[model samples]
Target: MGIITGGTRQGHEPELTGVVIRSSAGHLLVAVDGTIWRCQMRGRLKRGKRQSQTVAVVGDRVRIGAQDPHAEPPRGVLEEVLPRTNRISRMAARRTGGHVEQVLMANLDQVVAVQSIAEPRPQTGFVDRLLVAAERFGVAGVLVLNKADLPEPADQKTMWDYFVSMGYKVLRTSAETGQGGPQLADLLKDRVSLLIGASGVGKSSLLNLVEPGLRLRVGEVTGKTGLGRHTTTSTELFPLAGGGFIADSPGIRGFDPWAIAPRDVRDYFPDFAEPQQACRFRTCLHRDEPVCGVKEAVAKGRIPRWRLAAYLSLLGDLEERAERLGPRKRP
Candidate 1:
């Protein structure tokens, strides 16, 4: 039990139920039922230890307490965070290098992978990488192919068919055309969906189209790079007019598996999920191992070659890291 530090004289304020909408500038905006509040993390609570430095993020259900709880203007401290069902995090920025964490959002039901059709052409490797992370965490992964109104471009029908065939849902939307908004909205109607993708993918633009009332700041594409300027710097959970909630985070051009082990990376690919067990060696890394089914599948056109290349790339990275950190020497 927590004893109130007596910031109020009359009586200790009661804790109210809330969900963190955003955490930034040392303040957390928690939506309490129909209302909202600006909250701070107490210094004392920041003590003891942290499972991670990122205690609060968008979509975290929390308990709030404030001596003065104004309806329109509210302020308080985040007394506690309810347990999360599942979270979406990336390779947190690190210094010493074992691993560090920067959780982008919490309690995510799905991730809408937004891949722009143009500006900065979609990156297959990046999509696969994020999907791999989602699979490891058991979070549902969906794909959103945006910017479909551009001039003749590469990867139109071919790419869409690939993921759809893989049993993953894909929404082809054009913010300018209002193409797939309704379908996409219906998909996100009652679930916690987080939008993720490259910088120039029109993530914010698509959100605006999904709900014109949102009016989020949208940045123009860089003339030289043909990529989007970063307009969103933090993660925010928005309540959709239809139903469920959506959390928008900073653009992720590339996703490293965070702290995910290399030996376990193969299990992430949906195609590899079943066939992986067929490898000759139970511990096969799926690269050069004898009778590796995954690699063979790629050769026979069962798996996309690009995906195999990505898996091997990550596998090599982890193998190299293990070697470098092999048995630290005694000082």
Candidate 2:
């Protein structure tokens, strides 16, 4: 190994291997084997996205060039972002938000959506939306009903049964009682899974139970907001001794429908194809279209209105965004 370097050396880059664990304080913490390197955005990375959120996000595998550790504030140069096998993204929620995707996590084998059984009850709409995104990314998604020590209400049970019928892997876990711990552990083996859910649903707690070594900080669920305090702080990939990685993401309150194309939205729903194709208009949004198969199905109770509603809502957002942006002019 060469002696310590001083400044950015593009000619002889000090490439570091890492998978982005977290993005916080405008710097990303990248992990190699065990050690995590704090890196700053390189000029190239900054220039890459002229108008958007800062540098690398969690889950990006990258080649970073190290800077002087002796510097007052250590900073490393991010060199290149490796191609991702699959990534979870949401509609970009910012000024620079066009059709640009705000990638949440990259290259995950599965996503476990943790929802509470009571207190702040589970939202099936949100769950379906996540399922749609998972299907779109070709990643497996499991529904985790946390706080199982608490009783499951009628609505919660209904939601649980619905997803169960649809073939979604559902887990009823109690962070306090250690319920579903073994099953969760088994599913996690040899897979890079992403744990996502609304704030204050015991994500950190469940994770702690899974890996006592992690000991991640748990946040108090504020009654006023029905949300969990910022606990994870940053998104980071943590290793499991059994052989896998899990990204403990920061509190996610509301998932917005941004940047996705309208035509492609139906494909994500999974339950839409067979029936939706029979829609009167080939492009029928199933909204106000006459004799729409989807609308009829909803009337006959063949399909749930809530699911169709989700498709319509996302479809509307995409259409509205398209109108707002208008057609990009070719100079």
Candidate 3:
């Protein structure tokens, strides 16, 4: 789609071009130049398919007609949604144990999957899945290991090295000590990046360190559960001091790949891409297959054992979900 500057339109009604910065319920906050407008989607746009919870999200460029030109808090009606380059989404649960795609943000450049080494311990599975999702959506992915001052488990350290060896950019950060903030800032400069991770992993803390003005509310890990209390209720995009934008989304404990088949999961892992070509069967699922290049790589110490285990675990989850749904269409 062609880009248009603000206050430019072709019709009779006065429409201002803006980007959706935040959406809650049926109201959206659109930013035009230095002004912010509260808007509601046009009637026709509200009839979007029910597969997604909302039709518009943060980072969507839109055309809006002013509801009141002189109101204290400006009001407008969202007239049109411009084309999006790409989006990041997750599989939200359905009543029948099925999954629906939930778009978290649109037009993002990269996903920074944050994890903590100590409190609210890191789950490699979650990080890996986010990277896979990033790959599926054609977005760059970065692994941020937060709370670097805390002691890390031996396995996790090895896994970190493995990810680096596999060509994934990994950063060790400590929001408390400001370690690795400059490096992360350099990478995030002038880019629209999404910061996502499990609760209490310091996604907010890290943002605060990078841009002190953000002052995003942060919660501590509960003593009993060792999980963080949800601090950010919804996803919202914020501008960084240096440059670019970062969307701080609510902490997510569980994430299932949306509309993905078990066989497609292996292709998302970079280590499996080249080796799987040598497998005897073209459609090998890499599980219990007689001549599997992936399995062979695992046995030969080429691919990390824990990563393969994580992949299998996700595959089993998908299989169980498919079984639950019985006969359903695959995208």
Candidate 4:
């Protein structure tokens, strides 16, 4: 069958439209009308001065040129990437100098930040960073404490409640016992979601439980380091039987949101908004600033101290990065 039919013509060549389901090593797997096409991007798309951002990523809708008729499996060239609704991105770890925005996925409806209840312990800082990035990118954020069957510390339960109180959907799930599977499945039923967390947090295991047919490989947390091993090496979108799709990505050790200025960081932390309004300076970052409403809230136990610490940690990173790279124009 033809790669795609009834598409708009571009200069007499019919252009097919598809969603990029998988992208790696400069190649993309575009899904067109239930068919998967192994495609390469047109040279022009990458020839410009757009080196800082990812050109295409999973969940991106793109228009591709006609496929070679004789090719055994469908193959095509991605001619253009359509505008994305939203995307989750982070500063790529660069061994050289400048920063590169790594778009984890495009057009996501929500991002599920998964963390285990025990084993490897919780990385609240990482979860905060992920949720902040989601907030900045206009994607809904969900916090999942996986391995719920394991004993959970009282403080962790308190933290979960705090996130819920802040208007976040927090789910306690255990893949081993099938707990919260239905709730998670319902949440993911018809939404384009991305599951992200540090290694060994059971992202794959949860996927396996929710969608058993996937049989995604699961890894164990190393006893020596108390860290989970990387199981999912690359990002790929999987269609759900119920509806919609979910993208599984490799676990990240750290997350630094791309192009976010230190001053703009507070905007992503909603809990700080109310308290920040009472600050002496409108531009106060709530760190070492006198008469700061946020500091006062923390002191009065109105806001959790850990939340401010997380905000300060991310703000400090962005400020340090700005010092090295200078001011960045907002996108």
Q: Which one is best on TM-score?
A: 4
- Ranking of candidates on TM-score, top first: 4, 3, 1, 2
Best by lDDT: 4
Which pairs, if any, clash in model 4? Answer: none
Residue by residue across 1-331, what tens digits does model 2's lDDT show? 1122234457875666678877775577777556667787776566554333445667778777867645544456678777878777776664554545567788789988889987577765788778878887788989889999998878668757767877889989999899999999998988888898877899999999899899999987789866677787667788898988888887676565434567777877766777787887888777888888778878887777777887787777667677777777100
Worst 10 residues of 3 by lDDT: 1-10
The candidates, ranked best first by lDDT, are 4, 3, 1, 2
Off by over 4 Å in 4: 1-5, 8-13, 94-98, 328-331
TM-score of each: 0.89, 0.87, 0.93, 0.94
Q: How does residue 285 of candidate 3 score in lDDT?
A: 82
Residue-by-residue lDDT tens digits, candidate 1, 136-204? 777899999887787635545765677789889988888889989889889888888999987878889
Each candidate structure's count of clashing pairs: 1, 4, 0, 0
Runs with alpha carbons beyond 4 Å of true place in candidate 1? 1-11, 48-51, 94-98, 151-156, 320-331
Count backbone clashes in candidate 3: 0
Alpha carbon lDDT at 315, candidate 1: 72
What are the lDDT scores of the predictions, listed in order? 0.77, 0.75, 0.84, 0.87
